[model samples]
Target: MPFSVYALGLAVFAQGTSEFMLSGLLSGIAADLHVSVPAAALLTSAFAVGMVIGAPLMALLGRNWPRRRALLFFLCVFAAVHVVGALTSSYGVLLVTRVVGALANAGFWAVALVTAVALAGPEARARATSVVVGGVTVACVAGVPAGAWLGGQWGWRAAFWAVALVSLPAIAVIAATIPAGRSGAALPSARAELRTLAGPRLLLTLLTSALVQGATFCAFSYFEPIARHITGLGSAWVPALLALFGTGSFIGVTVCGRIIDRRPVAVTAAGLVALTAGWVLFASAAGSAVAVVALVLVQGMLAFGTGTALISHVFRLADGAPTLAGSFATAAFNVGGALGPWLGGLAIGAGSGFRSPLWVSAALMVVALGTAGAAWTRRSAPALRSDVHAYEQGSSDG
Candidate 1:
């Protein structure tokens, strides 16, 4: 169980690095490809858009396959996409490759969640799930910064190459460590997963995910410029600052499982509140380097801390369709990813300083907090399919 969790986490880390690496190397990519920063930003947006479209679609396609085979297939395609991305010289070709890679990434995550939960056998589901998915947090802390540095020193293409190399090994690890089995329950039909997305509870969860994640990425997309304007940091220092924030995210991911298991609603509400405060502080105290870095660390933790909780929240809400619920949540995340930075960029274009985006982001988190509080006020939130007694009774057996 531990090995499978770690293997999936590593695969997710590699994918996460691939997704965010472009942000760190945006300037280099723009210059090398003879395009504007905004044009290069489109590449980032394209990846998110692909995930938004691919999450449910790919999940449906693999609805009947054994989870291990589904994962292997996706990782193989993911690796190939990176290889193509690294080798492509034409910006147009690279853009297509990135979109393809993002689709594979979405599929990998959707399938991996089910596989992780099944492998844990419901007893340690929360912790096992967290460990497997913590790869994204690790990427935020370590992989993204490493990719950024490699891009800065070697070239943007080199970062993609690094991701591909890591993914190859991750594929091998997952194949070796995870036993052969169909990870998700066999659906009567592919459309069955859609039921999870249609309910009020699931809808609310999706809305919260979109708003919270959108706010986060809105500010995150412009981190480098924000750091430069506020902290007077050079480009050379940006990656290190990113790494510091990532460290905080790592801590958040490690602790989130316990927090969620104890009280899902309270933890989520608290996380959003913290996220709001972090953004507000970032916008206000951004002029001071010390203050900015402090807020950056806080922002990383508060923003990312809700990730696993949110996933668990979805599963609880759907009670009937865990795999579908998980995939839908991922789709919501992609929706936020696609929209957040674009909104921030719009604000930036409107002559609002980089800090302006933080205001918009903070406001969004405030709204999310309100929604989460309302939905999760009771100890027996509707999202939780089973009560404490039921969960406890079943734990020993599972």
Candidate 2:
């Protein structure tokens, strides 16, 4: 991997930390600002909407700019947004700042993936992406927990201020280290990228991406309440358990490449199965602390592992439309992110047990799995039947 890749990873780490830290501080933020928890949750969804809106727009507008300059400029914008988020006092103003920050966050990831792929060349492209995305894994493990803890101890605003502090060094590092390469035509244009959606397999890939996220996060969005109600854990235990779940995600992402490279479809199927099993267990047997913890860990692992495979599969199917396909996967993720929390909240409101969300999650996973299996079978049926018929005829002749 290029040294520049590591620099990019640092910037990614900072961005990921800022994006995810809000989850930890949600309750604190609501109490501090005198808003409902659900309303505060809108900030999280706002970020997703921002990413969905900004990723393509930024990719297209910055299509002609130097990759390094584009990245640095966005990082600067991201940092400035953090400052806005940190300094704001009014609830409405803070919400707008969060949206602005998320917009910058989305563009950064879209651009970073293209730059990382270009920098790594054909042989190590997957490996390079893993390194860049590893930052997100780390954010889950460390950033969210720390931010939550800090918010509980001091104030929610402290967390955003801390993120701004981290961004200052990230900005300097990005300016100093990343190369100013003129990758004008290194990847496809946004229009060319969008055209990849024209392929039949693209829909399958998008469905898979959306389902995997929807399944996991539907259960995941209600994690704090689930932990308290189902596992008999106190409110204090939520962050620690979430941190543990993040640990599982880290391990999953780290090893996912090997699993997918060996057998993409099979591994994806297995992951869906594992995720379904995890939810089933959570619904039925999560009363025990050990069982609950184990289920959460497995859920995180399978969900993220499956997502990595699904996104990579989309990239492969896109063939000529690398960046656009990547953006499509990003968009699917945002869509799933939006759906998961909303639906999960509805389940809770319906007076079902905490496990009700798990049931909903399992159902979504079943649909996703069915979609993936159908698509794969359709894609492979002709070749498989042709090979089998020829082999049978040859055996009869012998």
TM per candidate comes to 0.88, 0.89
Native-referenced Cα lDDT, model 1: 0.79
Which stretches of model 2 miss by more than 4 angstroms?
27-38, 184-189, 381-398
Q: How close is candidate 1 to the true structure, as a TM-score?
A: 0.88
Show the lowest summed lDDT stretch of 10 residues, model 1: 182-191
lDDT by residue (tens digit), candidate 2, 64-168? 777678887888888887788777767898889878877777777777876776777756655666667667777888887778777888888888877777767
Candidate topping lDDT: 1
Predicted model with the maximum TM-score: 2
